[model samples]
Target: MAYEVLVQSVVDYAIYLLDREGRVSSWNPGAERIKGYSPGEILGKHFSRFYTEEDRHADVPEAALGPSLGGDIQFETAVP
Candidate 1:
């Protein structure tokens, strides 16, 4: 099986790659569909853009990055 091709073509799951400092380094088509952002628009941006204002104020983005950076973490959330 061609795993890379299968993952890249997924439309039902958003895939993101964040840098050490938590900026978006990669974006996928499914992420575009779910988050309303194109790869060009979101890449190089902070992943915090996906969170609510109150969450940002609470440092939720930084907190969330810890687990993902330490190891693979799968999560799902709906963004308005």
Candidate 2:
């Protein structure tokens, strides 16, 4: 699909999709490069895996699923 190609071709930003329950469902090449996890390693895992320990302890990942004023959800994380 054209969309698949576009997603895979991007290398400057990490782009991915999550399921309704916040599980990683689709991962792109950019995501693999930026996040350092192959699809095999991260698919089906919670998106919270990218968050810092303090963020996880604070439930920041779940909170990010909430509606946002700008109509876009974004957050930063410290990746290993």
**Candidate 1 Cα deviation (angstroms), residue 16:** 1.1
Q: Per-residue lDDT tens digits of candidate 2, residues 1-80? A: 99999998898889999987889999988889988999999999999888888999987788788653234456666655
Worst 10 residues of 1 by lDDT: 71-80
- Residue 80, candidate 2: Cα error in Å is 7.6
The whole-model C-alpha lDDT of candidate 2 against the native structure comes to: 0.85
The C-alpha stretches of model 2 lying farther than 4 A from their native spots are 68-80
The CA root-mean-square deviation of candidate 2, after full C-alpha superposition on the true structure, stands at 3.4
Candidate 1 achieves a global lDDT of 0.82
Model 2: per-residue Cα lDDT at residue 66: 69
Model 2 earns a TM-score of 0.81
lDDT (10s digit) by residue, model 1, range 1-80: 58667767988889878999999987777989988899889999999989988778877778778786785444454455
Q: What is the Å distance of residue 59 in model 1 from its true position?
A: 0.4
